[model samples]
Target: MTGIRIELSRRERAILRAVAAGRGVLVSSCEPALTIDGCWCDHAAVHNLVEAGLIEKERQVPYGLATPAVITRAGEAALAEDPRST
Candidate 1:
């Protein structure tokens, strides 16, 4: 990986960690929902991660449905680069 690094808030970092651990999902709804093991997570943080292209749905799903979230290459890079991850 390159030396490029991305800054992330604590919540965003937690969400990324959860997704990397296979415990996160994105539910498509009137307001998209992010969940970890069926528990709610901060919407703003989830949205921010998605918008930043660090995480994405694992597969396509219809509206009002849920799909597993997967960390993107950028996400992996971010996790690897984050000092807090150590």
Candidate 2:
């Protein structure tokens, strides 16, 4: 862990949980899209997670394609800290 604490909103936390469950992806296009189980999720929240280094794309794909989202070490740490995780 980087020892940096990241704060997440309820929505972001849910999104991260979904990603951690192998149900999230980022579709790269003119407007990037975040999806969970083939359904749309909060784009801004996904952006926030990515920016915070909590999650990332599993691999590079074509411009209009998508890749699986993987939780980072920081992401796991954040989930561990979730109040509901106790």
Candidate 3:
């Protein structure tokens, strides 16, 4: 996981778990729900995941937040690295 940086904090790992459990289009809320802790939407995670090619952000026109990310294959693969995530 060379290009994949960061030694994830405990809370960060939990957030990743929440993403994994997300179904449908994985449209997670900015505010975490029952299974997720809301505070995890930090810039650090978004930057790192983007750098690692594990997620993507779409520029929304006439919609909600201009840049919201949906998980990618790399993200699922990254999550698969931890058994707790799967």
Candidate 4:
């Protein structure tokens, strides 16, 4: 299989690492479809991550409900490559 390289900022990397650490499952805001570490994350950052194929938004819940952010295999690979990640 071909390999993919995704360059992410410190925050983006940390977000992906955290999500991956959670076993590829993370609760995100429903309406905004954001929030990485309990706070609202940059919309563009989230979009970039998703576009990079590292992360994906799960089914959308109600307006006040929380949704899930799932880490793709590519996300796991990125986290594995991050030396600062645990």
Candidate 5:
């Protein structure tokens, strides 16, 4: 088996930074508390993170529809390694 190489894009890094600052967890697609030049994270970026096993999404029915996400251990490690993520 091979290992996955984590390369974070500028957008992805922004998302991770937001999550990390929120104590490593927050609602997916929620308005970012942190943004770069007022640019918040998008759905595609969240989906990409989920697919990469860097974030975990759980089903929730808050106000009838929503799913929250939390950063995974791998995600924390990734952020630690990627200086841009901080």
Candidate 6:
């Protein structure tokens, strides 16, 4: 396993943390997703996280929507290090 280090800006960090907290929240009758202000998170900001190696993306099951970004172990570490998160 690679030792990944992800650096996030203030807003990006918060958004990712929120998304992490909102994970597995049901988005539909058969799938799970997260929402922000009634906006289903396609998690485009995750591109930065991905470059930093903080998270990974995968295609949705059954429907094959855009790759949903998910927190990697490194991402959890980053979130934990953020004292502002709660």
TM-score top scorer: 1
> How far does residue 68 in candidate 2 sit from its true spot (Å)?
1.0
Better candidate number, 2 or 5, judged by lDDT = 2
Q: Give per-model CA RMSD.
A: 1.9, 1.7, 6.1, 3.7, 5.3, 5.9
* TM-score attained by model 2: 0.86
lDDT of each: 0.87, 0.85, 0.49, 0.67, 0.60, 0.56
- Candidate with better lDDT, 2 vs 4: 2
Model 2 residue pairs with clashes: none
In the range 1-86, model 5's lDDT, one tens digit per residue, is 12555998888877776665543333434432222234445767766777787766544434433344567788888787887764
Question: What does the lDDT read for residue 48 in candidate 1?
Answer: 82
Order candidates by lDDT, high to low.
Answer: 1, 2, 4, 5, 6, 3
TM-score of each: 0.88, 0.86, 0.48, 0.68, 0.61, 0.52
- What's the CA error at residue 74 for candidate 2, in Å? 1.0
Stretches off by above 4 angstroms in model 6 are 1-7, 22-45, 59-64
Provide the clash count, candidate 6.
0
Candidate 5 achieves a global lDDT of 0.60
Clashing pairs in 6: none
Residue 5 miss distance in model 2 (angstroms)? 1.5
Q: Which residue window of length 10 is worst by lDDT in model 2?
A: 25-34
In terms of lDDT, which candidate is stronger, 3 or 6?
6
Candidate 3: residue pairs that collide? none
Pairwise TM-score winner, candidates 1 and 4: 1
Q: Residues 1-72, candidate 3, lDDT per residue (tens digit)?
A: 455534455545555555555521222345322223333355565556556666554333332333334566
TM-score ranking from best candidate downward: 1, 2, 4, 5, 6, 3
Instruction: Give a tens-digit lDDT track for model 1, residues 1-86.
Output: 45656888888898999999999989876665889999999988988888878988898899988999899999998988899975
Candidate 3 runs further than 4 Å off: 1-9, 22-40, 58-64, 84-86
